[model samples]
Target: MSPVVVLVGPPGAGKTTVARRIATRLGLTFRDTDLDVEELTGTSVQDIFVEHGEQHFRALEEQAVATALAEHDGVLALGGGAVLSDASRALLREHRVVFLDTGMAAAVARVGLNGNRPLLLGNVRSQMKGLMDHRRPLYAEVARHTVLTDDLDAAGVVDEVLRLIEQDRA
Candidate 1:
């Protein structure tokens, strides 16, 4: 199997951007769970939540994660809360997981005032901070490597991920 590299992080942590770069550098197919979910459902994530609620959206998110994990060769960027699901976390354990860690200020700035993020719609700063507190430990537990993204640009983060992949191979 071509090794799978899974990127997990909170919103605005540059997971998708870095995952895309890393996939390109490694000659792997790129897949984002959120994108897949949106594509499969034919609706924006915000619309899903507003129409069907979080529980419904999460069911779709879980399915997306499962499909991504089953792929033999690809870079997968998971939704921010995907790790919260036990089934999703279990599937991720089969891959090389990377946590793109960033601070609350950075996350807030990056995510901005996006109401599309259901969890981050109101008082996003505080919501983000709370998410970080809850999710950071889970990210650490699942990740084979952690890249601090506070100061790194997307390219720099991709470089770090590449180095880690090389190290693992060595």
Candidate 2:
């Protein structure tokens, strides 16, 4: 399979939205690892976290990401926490990984205190802050390019990504 352009970021960084647009513009398939995990397990991510726990969910996520990297020749968006695992990070290193970086305020504004996000269910602002602090370095380590999404909309992010990809090619 051809190499993939993988999107990795914290939630609300617009990975999914930007990936879809980029995939359309570039004529590539769009695959979200979280969605793949959900489909394979026949349950929502929230349910997986609630019932089976984060560890289990992450195992499934690892598998999903590995599968996407190995078999997909397109745009792939990984779940926010996917980069935490060494296995996932190793897989990402071989692909064109884009890190959509967003500040805590922007992330909180975009994700809110939605119950859908199991980790941010309580004190979302603080949780998001902590998450960003913890995961920022990992995202940076695995990503070939880092796109700041604090002020960029989905279209703007896609535009920036396309520019960066073109630059990489050049």
Candidate 3:
């Protein structure tokens, strides 16, 4: 099976929050690859990165994303950097992908330079800016629909995604 809704975006774009709400509204299950990776390792995403390193964490993330895409028939949320994998991006193309586009300012504000984020540990703003800028094209490449989450609350983003799903169905 494949996901009915797949969320792709940078950190703080509300992929997890928006995907969960959309799943509930659609009466479907919600799954996040980050959570899946954590469950697999019995640790947090940050811990995985800290312990085994980014490359290791990314390898695990790619596998988790692959499995979830093949097996899940629900709303799926990808880790921020999941699209970095060419394999993952290719897999995403066959699904209903939505890009939660967010500006650097809004993203930084939402994330708040949290310690929980492994990649943004050094300088959250600059790191986030770079990450977002680098990933924007990848996200757009895989997503059939795009919603700028910078100006919208979770509910508003959810509404837009729902509308896109509905429109896609029609």
Candidate 4:
């Protein structure tokens, strides 16, 4: 099954929210690999990171993205770091992928310092900065489209994604 669209971005980039809205507007289903991983392990993402470590979580995320990319037929939102996997990046090249780009201030404000995010542990802004800096290229390398979400609301991002999907259909 081929996904209608796949969304990739750094954490706090509004991927999930925008995907849900796009799915609703398009009358398609919404699937998030992060939630899939949680269901697969019967635990929260934070717990997985805390208990099994980032490598383990990344493995699960990679598998989740692989399965979703191969099997899902709707709007799919991947975990922020999913593109870090070469296999996932290659698979993403076969589909319509959108990267929701955001600025550091917006990402930090959206994510916050005291969230359950596993990557933003001690110093949220600094860690998020590092994460975004390191992963931006990976996101760009696999994405077919990139929408800056720093100024737009979720609806605005959804509008852009819908436009991208329509362009793909055309």
Q: Please give the CA lDDT of all the candidate structures.
A: 0.88, 0.91, 0.94, 0.93
Candidate 4 lDDT trough over 10 residues, lowest sum: 111-120
Give stretches of model 3 more than 4 Å off: none
> Taking the tens digit of each residue's C-alpha lDDT, what string does model 4 give over 102-164?
999999999987557888999988999899889999999998999999999999999989988
Task: Mark the regions of model 2 whose C-alpha exceeds 4 Å error after superposition.
Answer: none
Best candidate, lDDT: 3
lDDT of 2 by residue, 41-141 (tens): 89999999999999999999989888888999988889999998999898788888999999988999999878888988889999999999999999999
Ten-residue stretch with the least lDDT total in model 2: 1-10
Instruction: Give me candidate 2's TM-score against the actual structure.
Output: 0.98
Query: How good is model 3 by TM-score?
Result: 0.98
Please, what are the lDDT tens digits per residue for candidate 3 over residues 55-80? 99999999999999999999999999
What TM-score number comes out for model 4?
0.98
The residue ranges of model 1 lying beyond 4 angstroms of the native Cα positions read 1-3
Model 1, range 92-115, lDDT digits (tens) per residue? Answer: 787899999999888999999987
Q: What's the lDDT for candidate 1?
A: 0.88
